[model samples]
Structure formats: structure tokens, C-alpha cells
Target: MTSGLQQKNSILILDFGSQYTQLIARRVRENKVYSTIVSHKITAEEIKKQAPKGLIFSGGPASVYDEKSPKCDKGIFKLGIPILGICYGQQLIAQYFGGKVRRTREREFGRQELFIDDHADFFSGLPGNITCWMSHGDYVSSLPKGFVSIAHTLSTPNAAFASRDRKVFGVQFHPEVVHTARGSEIISNFLYRICRCRPSWEMGAFIKDTVSHIRQLVGKDSVVCGLSGGVDSSVAAVLIHRAIGRQLRCIFVDNGLVRNREPEEIKTIFRANLHMNLDFVNAQNRFLKRLKGVTDPEVKRKTIGDEFIKVFEEEAKKIRRVKYLAQGTLYPDVIESVSATGSPSAKIKTHHNVGGLPEKMNLKLIEPLRELFKDEVRELAKQLGLPQEIIHRQPFPGPGLAIRIVGEVTPERLQVLRDADDIFVGEIRKAGLYNEVWQSFCVLLCIKSVGVMGDERTYENVIALRCVSSSDGMTADWVKLEPALLGKVSSRIINEVKGVNRVVYDISSKPPSTIEWE
Candidate 1:
């Protein structure tokens, strides 16, 4: 789906392998213009093919001094598109075009106050003493002829530069990340004033366009969506179904990790409101069989992943030549997985917590939400009139309870963890916390801890409850629950769930700890 403004104001972001490059695309989309992240090595012909209104160079973890550091061909500059260069991007722009760059004795990182000079086009509407995220080891010492320094930090004088005549802008700091206060406004300024893009990106128009796109892509051929009942997959299914009616088939395999009653709810919605083909497969036995005795987290992940693909392949084969495999792959995965930098994007964290997919699957992929962030997907979900239960459901990894259950996959353990998790989420919902928090769930630790219950010493599994506050799942801080609320949750889980003797809350955030333990 494309918005009118999105159609007209398309921006091509050349990836320099910056970890936050996808974050940049997310920020730009939030501003109401569609942005695409492409590798810096993308050919001039490819850029011409996209026909972007503006171009942006993403910052990378590389220094310009490195021999193999990423660089675009000189032809990119002469493309006549309004160009924006971030950190490494800025350094590349200057160094290649007769500017000087030097490694800093003391690298600038983390939060810094930006001092914007009136001459800077990128900071036209931005305020002085603005906060921005900086993560660069090298600094731009000089600018090419005709270019002017527009902004700077105390440590870095050439923080920002612009050549209004050429429509070229560069920033040494990242405006895509939240660490930069007013980052969104700075991006909007570039999109609206400099790039001259109209704010035509909207969710409603996107839905209409996506519906049309689906009709064209899957003409007369049946399309199958691998629904996990999560926001991403479900939203994709709804949009496609709206576009093509019964031609869209949603197959939900109960891989046995979903929360209580999710499969049933999913079936009811798709059958009643969506009027699409809904198939529910209880593949719990097959998944558990494949995961039996797998203790290593990585091994378990691979096992489950392989098994899921096999199951999907088998189901697709039975369907007699399924043309497309629809997924909920988001923009972050597309950006990070296919980085512009020479480095493998696999080094970065995954958008989905699930294990990698087997490469042998032959079905053509159809991912409707591939260009959107989690929040944007939600906006589209709301526009589609999906029930709040489905739309506002807390984020759950595709791997399901497998990651939550620290050890081997077994029916008994799955049941125990599922029950505890149900109580945990149920209480959170009872307190009106589901929509408020980004993710909230319970983890069943593999090790059994001793506890005293009434005069008896019981050896029981310990369950850890995790809840975090975040916009996207990229980075997060642990949610702060009141003492009363925590007490109630802890009491209920221990009392109601068998085999779970003790309950503890996970207070660690994403940096020191990932949302999931496994």
C-alpha cells in the first residue's frame, strides 16, 4: 500500500551499514512519507529505477580511513537528487569530494547538544542546543568547495554542512534515533522544505492501495498467509483478505507456544468478520516431538525453526501448488538483514525472536507489512477495524513459549508455562496494562528451585515475569509496576498455577538483558 504523499515523496536511504539505519526509515515513515533503505553499494541504475525524490546516506560503524569501508560511486552525487549524509555518510561525502576527515583521539558517542548555525538547511526549524545521538570515531575536518558548515558540537566544529545550491545536507549526529531530541522535526524539515515532499502518507490510503496490490499479485491464484495470530501476520491477513476475499487463505499452525485461546479467537474472527478461508492445524505434537530433549537454546531454536518450515512445506504441498507464502516481516528485518555495509546484517539483533528459516522453501514470499514498523502496522490494523483484542495484543515472538520455556520442549512444561503466562497476562489486562506496555509475559525457567509451602519443602519450577515499555521492540526499558500490582500478580501465579512455586519479576532492560531469556 502506498499513500499519495508516499507515492510522490519516496526517499531512498543508501545504507552505510549503520545499525540504526532501519530506525531512520521508521522515523521517516512516521513523518508521513514512505522511505526505503537500500545498500550503499546499490547501483546508479537501481537508484534510477526507484526514482526517489530525495536520497539519504545512513551512518555506519565504519571509519572512512578503513580500506574496505563502504563508499558510493561519484555518479551518486551528480544524480541531482536532494542528498542527506549522516555520520559516516557525511564523512564519505566530504572526503570523496575534496573534504578532509581525521580519526579523533577522543571519539564522540552518546548524547550531545547540537549548536545549529543559521546557515544550516537541515536545522532550519530546529532549535539551538538541541540533543542528538552521536556514535562516530572520526570527524570531518573540512568541507568541499561550495559547501558550508551549518551545525556543530563543542568537540566537533563541522557537525553539519549544507550546499543549498546543490541541495546537499550532512549531519555528524543521528537524527533518526530518539536520543536526539526533536529528531522527528528535523527529519520533517528535510522531507517537507528541502526535499519539498508533500505530507501525503496516510494509513487509510495505504490500506486501499495494498488491497489493490494484493488483487494484482494474487490474481486467480490462492494466497496463503502463515498467521501466528500476532499483530503483524494477522494484519497482513486482514489486508489481503479485504483485497481478494476467499482467494486469501490463512493457515494458523498451533506450534504450541501461543497464549491461551489465541487460536480459537483467531479462527472466529477470520471466519465471521473476514470471510476468508481459515485453516487451523494443531501441530503441537509434531513441534514437541522435534524439540524433545533439546536443551541448548540455539539448538532448540534451530530444531523448532526447521520443523516449522517442514510443516509449512508439507501443508503447502498438500494445497496443490500454493503460489505465495505471506509473512509478517517488518521493515526493520528488511533493513538490518540486508545491510548496506559489507558486514552481515545478521550480526544485528533480529526483529522476530524466532530462529532462522530454512532456505530450501520454494514458495514465493508475500509480506504486506515488510515496509512498516510495529506501530505503523498497528495504525493500519486500527484503520481496518480489527477488534482491540487482536489489534492491541501485546507483542509475542513467533517462536512462542519455546523461548519462554528455558529448557526442553515438553507437553507438561508447555502447559505449566502457558497457565502461568495466562495468569500473568490476564492480571495485566485486568489492570488495563496490556495496551499500555509494549510486551508482558512469563518465562518458565528450566531449573527447579526449592521453596517452603506450608510445612513442606517443595521442589518446583520458578517462573520469571517480564514486562517492558517500548515503542518498537528494538530497544526497551523494563516496565515499572506498582508494589500492589506486583504483589497481586505474584500471589496469583504461585497460588493458581501448579508446578510454579515461586514468581519473580524481570527488572532488567534491553541493553543488559534481552526481552526474552532464551
Candidate 2:
């Protein structure tokens, strides 16, 4: 979704480059109030134009005393809206209001106990003692004018302060993170009582508005959806079809990198169940030709992405008037491509649909699920009456099995990976753990290991099984499979699939290791 929408009664979060800035927005949205994240350097006029009912200053990494620290327009406080500052945001508020802030001798990095004071509406329904998540080195030394200490920890005396007259509040601990007990309740108090915001936002309303918006954007113009039989594209295609019924055409390209029988399954489902105009393109030779000797991950992604667009352009020529190209680009793709807060973050990897596309293309882009997380999209898919099979399908990268192979793109390697992956997933389903884990896949390693099979020395390729449980793809933890289950999978893979001998499970989490091997 674009940032230009004029959502009414929304909350504006001025991001100060915190890693948890997006979490703040997610928390606000969870409260059923629309929230948008913008750079801290946004001008006062822009804030006035958005006309938010509340303002939230997100936590940041920089100290407020630094000259280069990110700052918001001073005039924002004069907007007469309820304000809540978090972590570094609290320091900025204190410094702006004539309070002293200095680096503390000991930094509070993890969970800490907070002793609450008699602040009327700030801590309305909370107990005397609560746990909070704190990650800051600096603390407010003195209270600002007309503000009283609402809460404090052992080391941090002025942990939280509020000014009832000015409708301003500050908290040194992060209430957006799950580590803080009753964090949602505190945020709910701010939204419902302090900001006086109504809980009007829901997925149903979002669907209605997005459909209307899409219709308005593509007036009498045909749109083409690159359907990959995945949840994201399936939801996008169905939503766009709901808006412009006959003008939407779906193209399913089999690049020969997908799982077995995916193309035929997608065709049958879309045509028989959804009753939409669908086309199947067999460009496996085209994709494999361009990816003949490519070993670099980025090059493979770019080649696959560009080849998809070229194929789409060729198909668009056959259709009547295809002006817009629809994709199911989600919030994580945008966040990973470039930091949403305009801060410096390491580039994880390029999503084919997000960053690998060419600069210039024939079709304008239309992404309906851009602002949504994966779980939220699943909810939308369910609301739209999509079948359980599509709604609960495991997430597959846009580049398909190409990125799953570590070394190079070749027919022999692809077949080996495909067979092993099928067996792994089939076992997961048989164990009734398919829906329990977020993603379960097999990665074909480039190296080979020596093994004695039936008293014969043999060298064969090794495969790594990656199964992770995550609320969202941003962070994930490896799933701990039962020993019996693991043994079964290992035995089946080693016994069934040829050209491979070893099977191992990955135990790495997201921070040190990504879900995908590449």
C-alpha cells in the first residue's frame, strides 16, 4: 500500500530509526486503529496534512544529545494530539521539555520490574508491580514541567512520566515488544482512553477499501496477475478479480524450478474452482538457459525475475489492453529491501518481485497486499472464501527451488532437490505437523560426504532439512522434531532418493542464520 492514503482518525508514528518501529505500528493496528510509519525528519506540514489523532515517537539507537541524532519538527507537539514517547523517544521528549538526560552507569538491556505510581489514566487498570522490556543506556534524570513520575525501576528512577494537562506521556521501556507483560493493555489504554480512538479498522474494512481503490486505480484497463499457486498471488488475483471481474487475467509460468505437479494443480484449481481466466506458460527451457552457469544467488534471482517479466510482456501483447501488473508483495519484502524508517539496516537479500525486477517495464505495478504481514494475509484469504489448501499452503520463494539449491542451477541438481523436498514435505504432512510449523524444506548442499552403505565406501551429496516456527518470517526459530520422526525422515530420504547419502537437520535461528540456506 502507498503512504499517500488519507486515512481518518489514524495514528502517526514518527520513526527515529528503531528496529522495533514496525512492531509499534503492528501493535497499533492490532488495536484496530490505522497507523503509518514515517521518517523522523518529516516536516510539520506533512503531519498536519495527515491529521493523526495521536502521535508516537519510536525508540531509536542514537542518543538524543548527539547532534546527528534523528529529530522531528518541533511544531509537532503543538498539534494538540496525545503523544507517547518510547525509549530514545522518551529521552527526546525530556530534552525538549527542559529535562536533563545523561548516560547511565548501567544499561537496562532485558526484562526489569517496574513499580507503578498513582498516575490516573496512564496506569488505569494495572497492578502495583509489572515487568517491562528496557533497552537503553540513557535515562531521564529530572521530570519535565507539569509531569510526574508514573513508574520507576531500581536503577531507573524516572522510568515513566506523564502530564495529564498536556496529554503527553513518556516511557523508557518498550511496551510494543512481547517481553513486556501487559504491554498490549498499556498500549490499549493509550489508544482507547488517552487518544480517544475508536476500534473501527478491521480486515473486512481493509478489503472493501482496497477493492474500491484498485477499481479506481485501474479504470477500464486490463490487469495481469503472475500467479504462482501460492497464497500471496492467489489472494491478490482473487481480490483483483473481485474489483475488475472480466478485465483480470492470470498467468502461471512453470520455470521448471517448482515442486512436482504444481503447475497442473494450479491450473485445475483456478479454472475449475475460482472460474477465472488463466493461462499456463511452459518457459522452463527459457529460464534454465539463462541460468545455465549462474552460481551467485543475486544473479540467479535477477535472471529469474527479469525472465518472468519478459514472458509476461509477451503474454500481455496477446491480451487486449493489459496496462497494470499485479503482485502479492508483502510488508516484509519492502522492509528488507530498504528500511521503512529510512535508517541504515543491512540488506538481507533481494526478493525477486520486490527488487530484482528491471527499472523500466511495460506494465504499472499494483500490489494489494503490500502493507500486510503473512498471518494477516492468511486471515484475508480465509475471509475471501479461499480454500483451506491455498490459504494454509507453505510459503515458497518467488524464485522457486532455484534459490534452494546452493551451488548451481542444473537439471540433475533440481531433480535431486525436488525429490528430496517432496519426500520431506510428504513426511511432514503424514506426521500431521504440516500446519504446526511455519516452513519445512530441504536444501541440497554443494558438498558431498563419504558414507558406507551396505559395507561399500561411497561419496554422495548431503541434504539439510530446515523447519522453522515463526509468527512472521522476520524472525524464526528452528523447530525441534521428535527423534523418532527425525529418524523416520532421515531413513526414508537416504533409502529412497538416489545420488544422496546424508540427511541433517538445521538448528539455527533467524539472527545467526536465515531460514533459507542462500
Candidate 3:
């Protein structure tokens, strides 16, 4: 099934094309209720099939007054499931069922106080006058039939509304966003108290279930998995290898996208622990030779993606009777329908997906960790008794430093960036910021600037340090690193790394900027 979360206590998020729609899913998953995000244009027939425990309407960019605003049919309301709507979702619910949406010139674009009324099911254990993140242009002035107002802000009188009989709830402010104090608790209240879903969604059960399912699916057939030594693929390899034992063939592709000593380190871990049939394909020359002079980002992505598949295919031909190809794809890579910045088509870089193979490969797709987020995958890995070093490792792009280099993939540039990145990550660990950041890396910019290192003019490659704190990789804020820490990191990188003279910190958030530059 395309809906990967079918077997769990699911929360269905009918995406209203909101940037934070995925955030709603992340929040639900945090409550241990597996959630799926489907397009708002989905018919009621589709909603009926998923059989969600609860329904949530996500906020969108569209105003309720738009002639072509996104909305779901009223028939979904009658599904007898607990429904909670956010921002534009609240407006949609109110507009459809005898509520008035007024366009206010004053926009509540940031934090707002929620004065909670105790007479509702939504505010079970939450306190009154709590702050929530608000981002909307329109406000719901009137309530829908059988829906009474339970909470309000200074500007929004109908901030929250509910129907006692129907078990419907709506909130004008986004509880999914982090700026909202006690937002997670409110979301938890909806999932546990309101919908009453079972809390059986832990990692231990997931590992057991996935292992069982993999055993059933592959039987005794040989499966080839690409192990990039990143958490995703490494964890996937460990899980699948544990289930199938000798049947799983792991191909560690040293695409030269890896850091110095990475291939050696990966070989050590897999060989020592799993002891399965491991093949190391040194495709660095192939990848770097193909990526030479590729300046355009999309072109680089396509070239890398295409070349990766070809290498994988070539490697697959060597191993006889390998009928399945496994990848370490996660939920964020699949669940995200739109970028958080509300950009055009949400141009995705092809670091993770080697662009799903053509018909000729004839390999059945096996993604054991497809349904899980990265953290959950780590948890599953831990349950499967994988080493802690492999489990707690930070995320590196499938294309590795190639994407981080920004312009082209060259051996010279890669070496410099690799050293700098190593130093940066090493120093971060020394300062104890490794666990705090979801991802932190050094970007090797193509441009070089003049710098004075001990009274000598040196024009060298520039490195941009990016460290963002995020629960999920969905929405993120730049980590407020201390000046002394930054100074130490900069001094170490400039002195130790031969590639560059300059070190810059990225202070941009995810809306106008993504974690990765390319």
C-alpha cells in the first residue's frame, strides 16, 4: 500500500497545501500515533479506505476568501472520527458549515495567547492563557452549526471551536510549530484523550514487526542493499541483515561522496558486526569523473543520480540472483508534498533517491525503513542490537560532500571540504553540540575570498558552517551558537584545514532557506 502507515493507530492529515502540513504529521508521530498526509483534493472514498483514527486539517497559504481555495468535502466530517483543524483548516470548516470568515487588515503573524475555556474536550490538561504560534491573514468570526467557541486570542475570538456531539475541533493557531508553548501537549491531548488511540507505536514493536514482514516478503531470495554508512542506510542494512541473515548482500559504494576514512570505518562496522557478504565498490573515479565541471545544481543532481543507478546496476550484475534492491528512504523524504518555504514545485535535490530504477533492473523495491522517521529508524537499530556509534551518527546526504560543495564534485575540492568538515564536526563534538543539532555540516562554497592569515594574502575556498536544531527535519531554526564556541571552531578549521581561509555561520531559518544550500 502507498499509505505506509496502514497497520498503525493512524491520524490522517488532509493537507491543505500548507507549508507546515508535514509538521502536523511530525507532531502526531511524536504522540506515538502514526500519521499520513494526503492531498486535500482527495475524495471521500479515499479517506474512507485509510481508516484514520483521527483527522486533522492542516493550514495552507490560501485565504478563505479565495475563489479557488483548497478545501475538503463536508462528507468527510460525517466519518465519526475526531477531527482537528488548524489555521486555514479552521476557516475551511467554519466556511463550509454556517461560519463567517472575516478578512482582517491586521495580521497575526507570530506568537499569540490562547485563553482557554474549560468547557471543551480539547483542553483536557492544558493551562489557560498559553502562547501559540499564529500565522494567518484571515480570522473565523463566526462558528459553524453545533460548534461552540472554546478559546480565543485578543484578535481572534473564534481561535478554537468544537462540536460536542460530533467530536469536531478546530484551532486558528498552529500547535505543530515550535514557537507555540505547550503545543505538543495540546496535540497529545487530541491524540490520546480525544481520539483514544493505543500507544503501541514504539520502536521495539516496529523492529519485530518489520523483521517479520521482511522475512515473509523476501523469503530466501537474495537482496542487495546499498550501504552509504549514513544512519539511514546503515540502520536499514542492519535491520534487513538481521532478518534474512546470509541472504542480504550489502554493497558499500565508495562513490567518493564519502569523507576520508569513511569507507574503511563502514567496512569495519559491517564486517565486524553483521559478517554478511559485503562488497566494496570503489566508484569514486566514476562519480568524480562524471561530475566534473557540472555547475548547475539540478544538472549535478541528475548526473549523480543517473551515475549512481548505473553503478548499482553494474554491481548488481556481479551478484547472481539478487532480486531485491533496498534503500534507506525515510518518511520526511516521502511525506513532504511541499517545501516549508512555499516555493515553486519544491525543487528536491536527488541526494537520497537515485531516481527509482527503470523497468530493466527487474529488482523488486525493498525499503524496510520507508515508514519510519530518522530517529525511529535509529531506535529500531538500537533494538536490533546494532552498535551505538552507527545508531547515533548524524545524517550525511547520499551524494555526500558533492551536494555540500555546491558547484561541482572534484577530488581536490572534495579533499579540502572533507578535512574542514571533519574538523568542524570533531570540534562540535568536543563542545558537546553534536547531539543538540539534527544536522550540522560545512558547505564548501565555490567562491573564494581574500583573507589575511598571519600577514599573508591567501585566496582559498570558503566554508559555511550550518547547524540547525530540529525535532524532525521538517522545520528548523538556526542554533544560537556562542561566540567563543564559534571562534574555537573557526580557528581550528582555518588552521587545520588546507582548503580555505574563511568560515561563516548560517543564521537563516528553513522558510527562506533550506538546511542544504544545493
Q: Which ten residues in a row have the lowest lDDT in candidate 1?
A: 346-355
Residue 480 in candidate 3, Cα distance off native in Å: 2.3
- Regarding lDDT, does 1 or 2 come out ahead? 2
Candidate that beats the other on lDDT, 1 or 3, i.e. the better one: 1
Could you give candidate 1's per-residue lDDT for residues 1-518 as a string of tens digits?
A: 56555656799888877777788888888887888777787888778767788999988878888997888878888888899899998999888778999998887778888888863456666667788888889999978999988888888999888888989888999898777899888888898889988666778877878888889988888777888878888898888888877777788889887777888888888778767788888898888888888887767766776777777777777675478878888865555344433533435443332226676666777888877889999999999888887788877776788888888878888889888888888888899988999999889897898988889999999999899998876667899998898899889888888887888889997644677787
> What RMSD, rounded to one decimal, does every model reach?
2.8, 2.9, 3.1
Per-candidate Cα lDDT values, in order, are: 0.81, 0.88, 0.80
Clashes (candidate 1): 1
Alpha-carbon TM-score of each model against the true structure: 0.91, 0.91, 0.91
- Angstrom error of the Cα, residue 183, model 1: value is 0.3
Q: Pairing residues by index, what is the TM-score of model 3?
A: 0.91
| TM-score of candidate 1 on Cα atoms, chains taken together | 0.91
Q: In lDDT terms, how accurate is model 1?
A: 0.81
Off by over 4 Å in 1: 1-7, 106-108, 143-145, 335-346, 349-355, 448-450, 455-459, 511-513
Off by over 4 Å in 2: 1-6, 100-120, 123-159, 340-346
Pitting candidate 2 against candidate 3, the one with the higher TM-score is 3
